[model samples]
Target: MTARQHDTVGELLARSHRLGADPRNTNYAGGNTSAKGLAADPVTGQDTELLWVKGSGGDLGTLTGEGLAALRLDRLRALKGVYPGVGREDEMVAAFDHCLHGKGGAAPSIDTAMHGLLDAPHVDHLHPDSGIALACAADGEKLTRDCFGDSVVWVPWRRPGFQLGLDIAAVKEDNPGAVGCVLGGHGITAWGDSSDECERNSLHIIGTAARFLAERGRPEPFGPVLEGFGPLPRQERRERAAALAPLIRGLASADRPQIGHFDDSGAVLDFLSREEHQRLAALGTSCPDHFLRTKVSPLVLDLPAAAPLEEAEARLRELHEEYREGYRAYYERHAGPDSPPMRGADPAVVLVPGVGMFSFGKDKQTARVAGEFYLNAINVMHGAEAVSSYSPIPESEKFRIEYWELEEAKLRRMPPPRPLATRVALVTGAASGIGRAIAHRLSAEGACVVVADRNTQSAEEVAAELGGPDKAVAAAVDVTSEEEIAAAFRAAALAFGGVDLVVNNAGISLSRPLLETSADDWDTQHRIMARGSFLASREGARVMKAQGLGGDIVYIASKNGVFAGPDNIAYGAAKADQAHQVRLLAAELGELGIRVNGVNPDGVVRGSGIFAGGWGAQRAAVYGVPEEKLGEFYAQRTLLKREVLPEHVANAVFALTGGDLSHTTGLHIPVDAGVPAAFLR
Candidate 1:
């Protein structure tokens, strides 16, 4: 490395340390960072050392030259196949398992091998909030092209150890003299002959993303002012927990025959799901290198046509069977005898929708990155779902990336430059079901999500369930009032730089005997539900428009809005107007590039005070039963006889708001468990 390049690395290494106290550094520790060094094995046999990597437990500002341990390239490359977890690490060192010389043997940074592959004189990697938002974005590669131009060559995620190293060489050959590559879902990498260019690129990419995120419409950016996000219903959590512990252990077990007890840590339960951890599916992993290890997708918590453990297991088996079939097909098509064999290439660990991520990796890096990337994928998937979809590399492309020998070599070679590495997102009404689910999803995807709700306590509660503090913040907002909505959006822009997806799921529902409903009641309902939705959407659009960003404006309407409901006259009427407004807004905002859409969900409950408090009780009275029976009522109302939750509704919203919805506008998608045969169907 040149003196100048060395100096650039030195500068970033310095600035990164400054990130510690900054709120933007929220979850950087859970993430990783690295740098390329000066020593190039001396041609004169003078030992030209080339790289120094981040040692574990060192914070950014606290870092110094000593903070990084030095490892030689050739020695580093030799440790590739000394299988991890086969025996104690120290034991292997004493046994001379591989080249083990780091002075103190602080396991060379996890991304050590990948860094060596860049071949660039100097490089830097970071999982900053800004760039991660975009990287963790669904189809973020495309977004990168749209925003940063095609100058950046994006490589699909892969396992970083051996494969990434080799893949980088292959990519270097494919592209022939490019600046650098980006690992989807993981952090970013930037390299230059001069350290300034490298540092500039890193900051530039991250800054670009930070600007993009700031421009994205985050409905509200409140801090964790919420005293609490509702605790998972313990009684229900326990019942479900007891019923599923063995099942979870079995699903996660590598050795199926053995009944291994699960480690019920707070982290595990913290992610436990009333929705059966289907939320986990929403967060498969946030980094791209994890793509290879986790196989680009995760298992979802989808119960089968029938339930009771056997049926659930059977359905899950079918899912695995399909993955296997797809994997076999992909391998057969892509793998010739000449093809390299990759372990865990076939997305082995499936996300049982409501359950947390599971793994079948050979070691910790694979397991951990795969899991983190899965979580990242989940957030982007869900957040994108809120905006539009979770589309990644196309199926054909995924197949190629999964089995491409050259691409595999690239991933193993070098870490990707941060795509949308460090960005923050704010989603409103992110407390209960859909909002909570989405907040968790975005957080896992790498964007710090500020969960907003009227219930301050519940909002904070949701934020807590996610990592902690800045990673996810919770706040309350009454979407109906223009003042509140404006303030909320302002707060969000202040908090996370700006917003990405402005999800309006906050509204009140009131069911009444048509004649019994007074005009005042009608006006009140309109203000809270319809008017409130408009206010939030209006403010979000203003901010986005001002920021020169055209983001997604998602409004949660009801299935009744598509048609009409006699009992829910006011809500239905208001919602119909809301849906119509979305179409109008879509048309008007199309020029602004801000996509507007509505989600019509049926049979949803236990979320808003509108649904559970008023609507449910009123409907229950009409049915001469308890209010909790609302799901049965709505399910029976539908042909499928199944209830849809707020998350499913949010999913449809997610699908329509991103790049996939690039061509779509003025549409009302439904997430009603297959309700409204003609409309939803």
Candidate 2:
């Protein structure tokens, strides 16, 4: 932790951030950066050479010192002597642990040797789209010479490993003037005596390659835009995309439920609209980093953009099956007897003619990043085909990288998924009260949440508080409006594939007796609680059915619904409607494996939105108690005498939907502490 040592690592992080900020420099978590520095050894109190490199699964853009692995440079170099050659290169990754400099901060990546063994103070191995384009081009070596004139060397296609590191080292030694090497069929690597020089070299290579492609590249490399492949109108495009998302996600999740991301960026639209796009995409991506997230290739829709909806869905199902079969065959073709079992046969990226791309992963960020990587692949294809043909590494090489033993070990080391890991939940009225608590709880349990509320600002704040768009997104929704309810469901589908959990928690109360209840009061209560719940559930059921992934719907009913509280006609009737809907829908949807349940709370006066908006004062007047003491008044009547907080109701929702109640449906759990009258008979 000396000043000098701190500055070195700090500078490395700063440099890493700069490079990662721009997608042109590298992809999300794609590249590695390193700086060799001197640090005092804990054992001998003597200066020792250390390599601070970006750790495995670390993204450069947000890298911290903790994300950098600290390794003993001398020890790392020594391992090369015993490196059991190319066939045994996989063993080298484990050996990195033995080279730790006082317990490495993070696990060393597969590309560790590329930085440690290089004859330089700083090194960067990047997967820049422009650089990869030239690397994967048919005439890449000649293009390298033509562009940089020996300042950058060309190293032929080789899987990234200890041997590739050695090969780059030797190439640097042989060409004394070389600043870097374009790794054929992979990426580019640059090194310098200083960090600044290394960064400049890396950028220079990328810029030069891009310029060369633009200057010498042919026009319309993918041929003219196909007649039926043009993009749809913006509004129509998104509408279609949203409409198809659930069905596509369902097919993709047949092996495992997947969170989804939609990208209608101009790049995706342009690529999909071209005549030669399918042929280029079939060549697959070149860099290993790209395919690891995007899969080898995308499943492109074969029909025109204007195809009939029913026909499109039918064709997509066929295409999905074909994609899976192709992927399985690819695995079988190159897998060794000892290779790890095939992970899954579903396509990670799907390209619809006019609808753009849909990428799926275990979570929102991963799915979004997967889509971004495919866009990078699209750019790489454009650049490569513009000059020579778009040629990537052989399929066998991609297969090897995809199923590498080291990668499998990395996967095995990851923590187990949370209970609601791949689930997406939409909670209406989530801006505050019980709905907000439910949203937070579901997010903590790893569900992507949509904070749907009539209050747009409050909902957005809640979504942000729950960890931004990756974890939660906000949707402006008026539960009473069927259009808004449908839009909320669409938002959930677009944000994280489709909904798996829906909470009908939105409510309003009118504590009026039959004589005092106005027609308007009764209508408003029924509209928001009873009718709103019905609309949301209907829309949710439609999406869940489309996804073919059974889901859960929980209604926040009330004790008044069963307890027949005095002077609570309008609200109680609405609650009764909700309670019955739960049983009715559960019986109907059970066939689709969709669970319907309810939670009946006596009176959540403290944090209830209904209570805060005049209901508490009105109810307090009827009970002859102060509004402040209403919670205690209700609790004293229950068996447990415990005040029900929003969190308690949220916990009840979780209990019913969080997997334990998988077999229990059409059931209502009373959350009024212990309301004897509210208990199910």
Best by TM-score: 2
lDDT by residue (1-681, candidate 2, tens digit) is 988899889889998999999999999998999999999999999999999999999999999999999999999999988999998998999999999999899999989999999999999999999999999999999988998998999999988889999999899999999999999988999998888999999999999999999999999888899998999999888888889999999999989999999999998999899999889888887789989988999999988898988898999999999999999999999999999999999999999988899999999999999999999999999999998988898898888999988889889998999999999999999999999999999999999999999999999999999999899999999999999998888888788889999999999988888999999999999999999999999999999999999999999998888988899999999999999999999999999999999999879877788899999999999999999999999989989889999999999999998888789999989998888878788
Residues 1-681 of candidate 1: C-alpha lDDT, one tens digit per residue: 457446745765665565434424323343334554444343454544445656544555466666665556555555555536422332322222143333523444445555655666566656555555555566667766655664455766654445555566566557654555556655565566665676566667667755655565252221121122223344443333334433333333322211111122233333333232444343344444345556655555465211365665566556655655655665677666856674432343444322233443332223443444444444344333332233344444455445655455545765542222233355667778667766665565445566778888988888889776546666668776666666565555433334546777766667787897889889987887778877877766665554444567777777878765557788788888888888788888889778877888874775654565567777777777778787877788777788887667655765675345677877788777666542843
Find the 10 residues in a row with the least total lDDT in model 1: 254-263
What's the residue-level lDDT of 591 in candidate 1?
Answer: 91
- Give the best candidate by lDDT: 2
- lDDT of each structure? 0.55, 0.93
Clash count (model 2, backbone only): 0
Q: Which regions in candidate 1 have their CA more than 4 angstroms from the true location?
A: 1-98, 101-425, 624-626, 677-681
What TM-score number comes out for model 1? 0.44
All candidates: TM-score: 0.44, 0.99
